[model samples]
Target: MASRRAAGRIVRGLGYTSAAAAVGGGVLYLSYRPRDIPGSEAAAVPPPTYGEGGIFRPPSFPNVKTRAEQIADLKRSSGTVSGAVEKAQSGITSLLKGDANDVQESNQGGKDEPYDLLVIGGGATGTGIALDAATRGLRVAMVDRDDFASGTSSKSTKLVHGGVRYLEKAVFELDYNQYKLVKEALRERRYFLDTAPHLSSWLPIMIPVDKWWKAPYFWAGTKAYDFLAGSENIESSYFLTKSKALDAFPMLKKSGLVGALVYYDGAHNDSRMNVSLAMTAALYGATIVNHVEITGLEKDADGRLI
Candidate 1:
């Protein structure tokens, strides 16, 4: 009975001790608790604690001025920049739009009428001129007995290049138009290759030189041709031994041939090139018609050839 009484007392003691410890912890918490303020608020309200002090405010600009105030401040501080923003916007638009009528539609009325440009011969020269005029915001019409490049242009040496023979002749020799044409042709060649790579590509040519002096001279001129190009699309000019040259081109006469200068230029089936260029021009807002003839040169009231 006595042992049972002792066990009961021990259980009661443990319960009392636990209750006392809990009450003591509660008292400590109450002692250090935040005291209620009598409405003494901070004038500089600390911003709410955002994560890591980085906040995502919804772009609400406070102390934001009205349009009048902003304008007055701008006039006072920076002043007007003339047409700064307008000019900038125009420049950006021009750059982005890529030429004035880049995205414009063509006047198909030329096809409805007799013609716009009466390209007499449908050779490269005429077709080229027609394409140039037509793409540059003019109406164009072409006529031939058959398809384009069916004349002298069709039978040329078939190179869209700086005529190397003329270059050699010009020891005091170079035509300004020819040089300009070479440079322009190189750029145009790039455009053609870019726009229609399958049809237009760089081609290597073999120029047979009979003498050592002629070989170096020919090589130099071709190098200059390649140099004039902003970028070389084909392999640079190199000397080929008689055997190598003959292997490449067996049709040349074996007599008087010392070595040959093999260089690159652009070549094409001129007829196909014309068709492709015409299609590209049409895509870029040029109206083109083939095989249609004009009875007479139409003139405006001012006597300007219409």
Candidate 2:
């Protein structure tokens, strides 16, 4: 009888647990289920509408060109390009044919107009000479074995410096020639930078001072350099502190680093500068040609070049 009573109690406990679980689940479902607020239906975005063509188009779709329009544009571009190419070819052909005709006439002993000066090369020096002669009202013609500035003129260090090293030698050895060369170079450097402002620029160069004593020495030397440049100086020389030096040149050795002296010099694109010189000479009425090799020179009985 006691066992039967215990079994009845267990069955009643299970029935109560099941009823609690059902109530909890119903409350959870009601609390967490999605609900629509009062004005949310009106606030919702509507589906995009397709126009009469039954196709959806983006905002930019109307700006897009049709196939025929694109084709016409391409055709116009190609025609412009072809016309420019043809014009360039005609100019080059005319120049080459004219040069060839001049040579042929000279070889055939025909009396052709003679040039006042005939430059044998198209390097910087030769082109400069041609330009000078042409500007002075002399007929000038220039030819090169290769393209202009193809040799050492193009392979330079590209620095239009005033020979700071030469100044050092001039001071130490008291060499008048070196001093004069430095002065001339400084004047030429100024002229070069001024002439081709587009191709050249002032560059700041730094000299590291490893020793404390060397700081004042380099500073004085650079100051002297600026003095020599005088009114033509691009910028004045300045001394930098040790920390500032490191900031400017991060790769410098920190130990025994006293300071640095910064000075200004001119730098340029050498090859392009040389080519521009040649073109300028041409514009000054000098006939400039390239890729014409001179195997030999002919001289008259009076030892004059013919």
Candidate 3:
């Protein structure tokens, strides 16, 4: 126990030393640099490149309105919220191709016009699948019984951390699948934060440890979680002394408090994100419709899902 406490003290001292050295180095480097060099002048911005720096002419969506125009129209629309929603919906619906404006039109287009992928839900999973299919140049269509994200997608607790609980289970149970789930989730967590800064952000969380003996275990596990994320890891996990943790979050229970594990995950607007996913898929030529019910499934002679 004495040795363990001494090791902890050494680690904390080294951390403080490292932080001070970083600050000193930064200050010295800045002091010695050319004062006249404007930050922007230090780097030349590269010219924007489109289509492999003049490869064979890229395909264009002829007769398609610019996204700016659609957004402008929505912003300029007036009247009730219902009217605005209808107008916005119409704007999105107009982007569909090959008689995708109506389900009846799709039927008229015949068996030849069947979608490559017909996703049956409008939540995160369905919209994500539609987006993936559409981007790969497949004919994609999605339908929902109600508004997008009206179901479980909208019921998220808004914490986008890796399934640390799953990771814990994996560690104890020696389950590889659970570890893979954590890794996959961490990758997605990074992608979500990077791809949609408007709807998502890095959120710091505190896992309070109640006993001195438990702090090392919590720290090791969290550090392993950070390592599993590789480049996608948001922020490294670290120990926070009891006073510091209390300073960060005063409402934390004081009794039996030893320290806390501080780490980052993501927080997001689930509903807005779901809508964006579907709209983005629509922009990529997928047909997305809501308020459409599928009461039964159709099957062929082989009993394939259709």
Best by TM-score: 3
Q: Give lDDT for model 3.
A: 0.70
Per-residue lDDT of 1-306 in model 1, one digit per residue for the tens? Answer: 999999999999999999999987764453335543322444323455555458645432213233353233322321111333443354345436665343223322222332234456666777677666555544444455566666676687666665565544544555666666666767777676566555655677778988878976877887777677756454566677777678878987889888788677777677787766655444443344454454565456666454
- Sorted by lDDT (best first), the order is 3, 2, 1
Per residue, candidate 2 scores C-alpha lDDT tens digits across 238-283 of 7777898999889999999988888888888998988888776655
Write the candidate numbers in order of decreasing TM-score: 3, 2, 1
Task: Output the better candidate (1/3) by lDDT.
Answer: 3
TM-score: which is higher, 1 or 2? 2
Best by lDDT: 3
In model 1, how large is the Cα lDDT of residue 236?
61
* Global local distance difference test of model 1: 0.57
User: TM-scores of the models, in the given order?
Assistant: 0.55, 0.62, 0.64
lDDT of 3 by residue, 13-80 (tens): 99999999998786456334443322223223344456775765644442322445433332332212
Please report how far candidate 1 places residue 56 from its true position, in Å: 42
Displacement of the residue 43 alpha carbon in candidate 2, Å: 58
C-alpha RMSD of each candidate structure in angstroms: 34.6, 30.8, 13.2
Candidate 1 accuracy as TM-score: 0.55
| Model 2 residue 97 lDDT score | 61
- CA lDDT, every prediction? 0.57, 0.69, 0.70
Candidate 3, residue 217: lDDT: 87
